[model samples]
Target chain A: MSLQVSKNGDVVVIEVDGQLIVGNRQELKQRVLDEAEGGARKILIDFARAGYIDSSGLGVLVSLAKRMRELGGDLRLANLNDDLQTLFELTKLDSLFQIADTRERALESF
Target chain B: MHAALDIRVPSDVQQIEAIVAQVVRRCREHRFDGRQLSLNVPVALTEALSNAILRGNGDAAGKCVRVRAEVTEMRLVLEVEDEGAGFDLEACTEDPTTPENLEREDGRGLFLMRSLMDRVERFRGDGNVVRLTLNRR
Candidate 1:
């Protein structure tokens, strides 16, 4: 899995290029935490290229969202595929975070 | 795809992704439902292995996780066992979706396993074993 960070206006987008599972969840978490530490107040995790995420990956996202909130910022998700979306809904996590349909929408939400 | 598979690996979370992928790949080869192959297999297997490695074995050194799979056109059954004390099911069913627990990261694995698989039954034998079944239909 790979992560790429891009800046759009004041929002920072972290794009995940592969499935997020236990093997690489820590790296994704660290990347976002680093972004938060570096003054990124609004972050969007773009998962357009990502097709899967296990609960550990979800855990990392939950942790990152909480951390961002504690820092007076927020984390949002965008472009989740149908399978990934079903996962969020199945775990009732769809209600926990703001999920957008597109990067443009997510960026605008920030 | 093998009609049955018995795999033993170290109790490390990092080993989970590949195992999940392999299971999903085999299920796909056997013509399991695409939905199960794409979503159910990987998610359920990942959760099972993660539970086995992290919660079941406590990520303890030298411990091992054992995985067994039986795949057929009719169904897919997987069992993951870890060499740790059995876990309390009451504690694992706390409803992570509840407002009080929504932000907590520790509970979703078990919930997803139950939701995605046709059957999720846990019992103790050599260790804590989580058996997951998915009907191919």
Candidate 2:
């Protein structure tokens, strides 16, 4: 998946394009970690363009959430479609991370 | 009756897209619902295929994952076979929802597979076969 990084105030928003699967989970993980390393405390993943994510992709998101929490910051997700929302609910990861419905709301959350 | 689909791919991670696409397209033709086509089919198939490739086959260069599907108006049945020793359904229990396992990197694929598919069963014949079924709504 191709990722585009932008800033809304201090919150860094990364827009993901395409399906997030095992083949591309690592690229997403490294990008988030890089943002954390660059002193971006609050990060948001905008899934406006992303269609769906596989289990591997969900695992990577879980790991990133844990890592960001340990670093005294957090990573949030926004603009997830209905299917993605159901995936997170089924896996019980919805409680582990803060999910917003829009980029503005996610930015406000951070 | 719709013709069954039979295909095979080497243990490559990149081929997962093509396989999922094929399964979804075929299921769609058989009147699978929107939720099944978008979420259940792709997520379950990806998990099953990736597990067959990476875990079951160990990503061996020569190993292949065989996929066979029988799609009817009532349901979609898919069997994914991997060139592995065997699979023990009873012994494969890892709860990713638990607090301890939540942060772990692995073990969610099986859960997702079971959760998405209507029925998931394992068999050992020529290879380890994972049968996934989704009933049409």
Candidate 3:
């Protein structure tokens, strides 16, 4: 998977393309942590083009969310497809993440 | 009729992509559509394969993970074996959904494999072998 980062005022939006699974979960984690370390308080992960995400992917997101909160930053998700949403719901992660329907809303959330 | 695919790879995390891609492609060829094609097939196969590489084989350089898949009209069956000590599925006790365990990253693969696939079985006569079965319908 490839991640592209862009800034929208104080919020940094990371657009992820391709699959987020065990093989590439570290890349996403590192990229997001880098942004957090760089002092981005509000982060948005745009999953518009993400085709697949496994348990490892979910674990990565959970770790990111926890780390961001510890650093006084936050991470939000946007553009989750049905399957992605279902996975979150089934795993009870839907409550842990602040999900937005669009990038604009996610950016506006913080 | 059954169409089979076989793969053997060193116990490396990098090899997971190719195996997952092949599983997705073959399942698609077997006419899995919609959510089954996109989420169920890829996610389950990836988790199973990742377990074999990372946990089962311990990422040993010379060790290998063997994967065999049989795709048919009724079901898709996959077997993943690793050249390491058997994995103790009973040892995994963390509940991924709980508030405390939600932030932990180490124990969710088995939960997902069981959740996404129709059946997940572990055998240890020769080596650690995990068999995953998913219904096409």
Candidate 4:
């Protein structure tokens, strides 16, 4: 998967493209952690282009959300497709994180 | 006559998915009227592949997973072989469809494979060979 990070004031938006499977887990985790540590607490992860995500990828997201919470910030997800939404619901992570319909909504909430 | 394609990769999940997609496409191109069968074999093979790549020979040098697809008049057979220490398939038995196990992150791959494919067979004697078959009726 390819990731692009953009900064909008204090909020950091990450756009993930392609499959978020086990191979791309480490890089994805590192990117989120780095941005969180860099003082971009309110994070928006846009998953419009993400095709699939397995358990490993979900684990990384859970860990990042926990880390961001510990840092007095939050991680929000936007543009999640039906499959990913089902996945999150199945994993009970949908209730754990703030989800929005659009990037603007996610940023505005921060 | 049946056709086959052999794919060898460094156990990367993305590459594995790509290979699975290719196998599915090939089945479609061959005019197999089994969309569900195509989805089943690939999904199951992917789970087996992930186990080999992430937990098996991922840390070892020059380790890879080999996937082979064979199409026949009666069925579609996919064999995913990994170069890792094979484990007993009989030991793992967590059902993925169970409501209690849905939230857990691990132990779902094998279950999904068994549920989706018509036949699921594991061969630890041959370096972790997982054969999935879908019969076209």
Candidate 5:
């Protein structure tokens, strides 16, 4: 998977492509931490290109959300696919994280 | 008659889902009715493989997880074996419905697997082996 980070004022947008599963968990986690440490509290993760997300991938998101919350910031998701959305809903993570339909919406949410 | 495939890869969590996808496609081609199964085998299998790759191997090179899939009586059975020291399944708290635990992350894989598969069993006595079975309904 490839991750791209862009900053728009106080909101940091992360675009993730390909699959988010066990293998890329660490990389994803580290990147989010870097963003948080760099002083970007509100993060918008774009999963429009993400095809699949497994449990480990969910774990990465949860961990990052916790980290961001502890730092007094927040993490939000955008462009989640139906399958991915089902996984999130089944795991009840849908209620835990703020999900938006577009990058602009997510950015506005923060 | 039944066919089987055995794959062994280093404990790299990144590669787990891809492999699971490959296996699921093959299983589907063999006429496995994935929809009838409670848990999408592809997703559940990926979760098992991820656990083996990430938590079991712990980023150690050379440590590997072995996966095998077989069909019997139109049912699919998947076995994931890891070389790492086994964990206590009973000790793992996997309640996904708990609000406090909901957003914390990192413990939902096992829960999802259990929820999706018809059968989920862990052999923690020796090497870690997670067995998942789904009947083509």
Candidate 6:
């Protein structure tokens, strides 16, 4: 799995490509945390290219949301596939995250 | 059509990605439905293998985890065996969906596997073996 971080004004859009499972979720987490620590207040994760995510990946996203909120910032998710969206709903993580339908909306939500 | 996949590797977290890839490829080749391919197998296999590597094998360098998958006309069966003693599902106290346990990082693997797969069975005799089944009809 790979993570690409780009910026839309003050919002950092992290595009995760490939499967986010136990093996690679930590890298994504570290990158997200680095962006949060580096003073990026509004973080948007674009999962348009990500096909799969396991419990570990879900955990990372949850932790990331909590971390960002603790820093007085917010983390949003964008462009999640149907399966992932279902996963979030099943796990109730959808309630915890501000998931947008598009990157534009995600950025505007901030 | 019928096929089988087998791999035995040392207990390491890094092996999960390759294993998940192989499972995905085989499932696709077997012509699983969208929900089975996009949701069930990925989540179930990753959870089962991660459990085998991290929990069942205790991440021991010398220990090995064996994964075998078979696809036939009836069902898709996956077996993951690790070198540890075993685990008691009844002993697990944490519920991932619980209000207090939702944010905990470590306890959702088993829950995800059970939720995604059609059947999740644990066999304990010589070692720990988790068998996951997904019906294909």
Q: Compare the candidates by lDDT and give the number of the best one.
A: 2
What are the per-residue Cα lDDT tens digits for candidate 1 across A1-110?
A: 99999999989999999889887999999998888878998999999999689888999999999999999999999998889989988878889899999999998887
* DockQ of all candidate complexes: 0.81, 0.77, 0.77, 0.20, 0.51, 0.73
Task: Select the stronger candidate by TM-score from 4 and 6.
Answer: 6
Model 1, retained fraction of real contacts? 0.85
Error of 6 at B63 (Å): 1.7
Pull out the clashing pairs in model 6: none
lDDT of 6 by residue, A54-86 (tens): 999999988888888889999899999999998
Q: Identify the CAPRI category of the predicted complex in candidate 3.
A: medium
lDDT of 3 by residue, A1-105 (tens): 899889988888999999998778899999988887788878899999998888889989988998889988889999998999988987889999999888888
| Model 3, TM vs. native | 0.94
Per-residue lDDT for B18-135 in model 6, tens only? 8877887887787888788888888889899888888888877898898889986567899899988888866765668878877776678888787888888888735788899998
> Model 6 segments beyond 4 Å from truth?
B1-3
What RMSD does model 2 have? 1.6
Kindly list the per-residue Cα lDDT of model 5 for residues B27-57, writing each as its tens digit: 6676766453213786798888877776787
Error of 2 at A83 (Å): 0.6
lDDT of 6 at B18: 81
Off by over 4 Å in 3: B1-3, B90-93
Q: Model 3 chain B, poorest ten-residue lDDT window? A: B1-10
Clashes per candidate (backbone, < 3 Å): 0, 0, 0, 0, 4, 0
> What is the model-wide C-alpha lDDT for candidate 2?
0.89
| Candidates 2 and 6 compared by TM-score, better number | 2
lDDT of 2 by residue, A1-110 (tens): 79999998888899999899998899999999998999988989999999779988998998898898999998999999999999989888887889999988888887
In model 6 chain A, where is the ten-residue run with the lowest total lDDT? A88-97
lDDT of each: 0.87, 0.89, 0.85, 0.74, 0.79, 0.85
